[model samples]
Target chain A: AQSVTQLDSQVPVFEEAPVELRCNYSSSVSVYLFWYVQYPNQGLQLLLKYLSGSTLVKGINGFEAEFNKSQTSFHLRKPSVHISDTAEYFCAVSDFLCGGTASKLTFGTGTRLQVTL
Target chain B: SAVISQKPSRDICQRGTSLTIQCQVDSQVTMMFWYRQQPGQSLTLIATANQGSEATYESGFVIDKFPISRPNLTFSTLTVSNMSPEDSSIYLCSASGPGGYTFGSGTRLTVV
Candidate 1:
C-alpha cells in the first residue's frame, strides 16, 4: 500500500507569482505519481504524471512537477499563476503492482490554491 | 485520456433512502473506480468495478452499503443504500487508459 501527504493545506499567491505545492509519499515499492486539479463542484483533471524516464514532467495549464525518488516527493510547480489556476490540487500515488489501474490511486489531502489579483 | 459522464450532478435525499449514481465512459476501460470525498477531506477509494466480476471494495466499505455493478467496459453504477447524513459526500467515478486517468463530474449527495 502507498500513502501520499500534501504538506500545505492552503496556499495564497498573487496573480503572476510563482507557486509550489509540496507532496510526499511513502511506499515500499516503486510507484507512479500524479497530480490532479479540481475546480469547485467539478471532476478531477489530470495535470501530469511521472511514470518513468523523466524526473521533470510538464502538465496542462502551464503546470509542472518533479519526481524525486530519494525524497519520496513529487511537488507541483508553476512559474506563474492565474486566477483561473486557483483550485484544489491533489497528489496521488499508485503501486505498479496494480497494473497501472487508476483505481489504485492513493490520494493525499488536497491543497487549496488561492490566486489573488 | 477518456471522457467520462456521470449523473445526477447533485441531489438531496431523505435519510434512510438510497441513491444510485451512474457513469459512462466514451472508450472501453478495463477498470472503473468509485471514490468518496467528504467535506474538507481527500478522496477515498470506495470500490473497483470490473466487468463480469464482483466489485472489489476497499476497507471500511461493503457491497451491501455501496453496491457496484459494471456490466460492460464503458458503463458502471454505484448505489448507496441505507443512507444517512454521514453518508453525504461527493461520489466520483474514474477510468484509466494509456493516456491517463480521467474522472467524471462528481455526483454530490446530501442526505437530510
Candidate 2:
C-alpha cells in the first residue's frame, strides 16, 4: 500500500514571501507525484505532476516542486506567494498498476497555506 | 483536459435519508473515480466506475452503503444510502484525461 505524508498542517506566510510545503510518499515501486490546490468551498485543481524525467516540475501560479527520489520527497515551493495563493494543498501519488487501467491516487492529509499581509 | 459537471453543489439532508450525486463528463473516459473529503481531512477514494462493469470500491467502503452506477463512458452516479451525520462530507468525482486528471466541483453534503 502506498501513502503520502505532508509534514505541515498549516503554514502562515506574509504576502510576497517565499514558502515551501513539504510532501513525502512511501511506495514499493516507482510512483508518479502530483500537487493539487483546493480553494474555499471549491474542488481540487491540479498544480503539477511528475510522471517521468525532470525532477524539477513547474506548476501554475509560479509554483514548483522537486521530485527527490532518494529522499522520497516532492516538496512544493514558490519564490513568492500572493494572497490568492492561500488554499489547501494536497500531495498525491500514483503508480503504474500492472493489469489495471485506472491510475488511482493516494493523497496526503493536506497543508493549509495561509497568506497574510 | 476533460471537464466534469457535478450536480447539487451543496445539500442539507436529514438523518437516514439517502442522497445521490451525479457526474457528467464532456468527453468519454476509460476510468471515473469518486472520492470523499471529510471535515479537515484528506480525500479518500470511494470507488472506481468503468463502463460496462461493476464499480470497484475501496476498503472501508461497501456497495451497500455507497452504491455506484456507471451507465456509460461519460456518466456516473453515486448514492449514499442510509445516510447519517457521519456521512457528512464533500463528494468529488474525477476522470482521467489526455492532459491529466480532472475533478468535478464536488457536492457538499451536510446531514443533520
Cα RMSD of all models vs. native, in order, equals: 1.6, 1.7
lDDT of 1: 0.91
Model 1 Cα lDDT, one tens digit per residue, A1-117? 789999899999999999999999999988889999998777788899998888999999999999999999999999999999989999998876243355377899999999999
lDDT for each residue of candidate 1 in B1-103, tens digit (9 for 90 to 100): 6899999999999999999999999988998899999987899999989999999999999999999999999999999999999999999998877756778
Q: Where does candidate 1 stray beyond 4 Å?
A: A97-103
| Local lDDT at A71 for model 1 | 94
Q: Compared with the real two-chain complex, what DockQ does model 2 have?
A: 0.53
Tell me how far the alpha carbon of residue A23 in candidate 1 is from the true structure, in angstroms, after superposition: 0.6
lDDT of 2 by residue, B1-112 (tens): 7899999899999999999999999988888999999998999999989999999999999999999999998999999999999999999998876556789999999999
The numbered model that scores best in lDDT is 2
Model 1 chain B: ten consecutive residues of lowest lDDT: B94-103
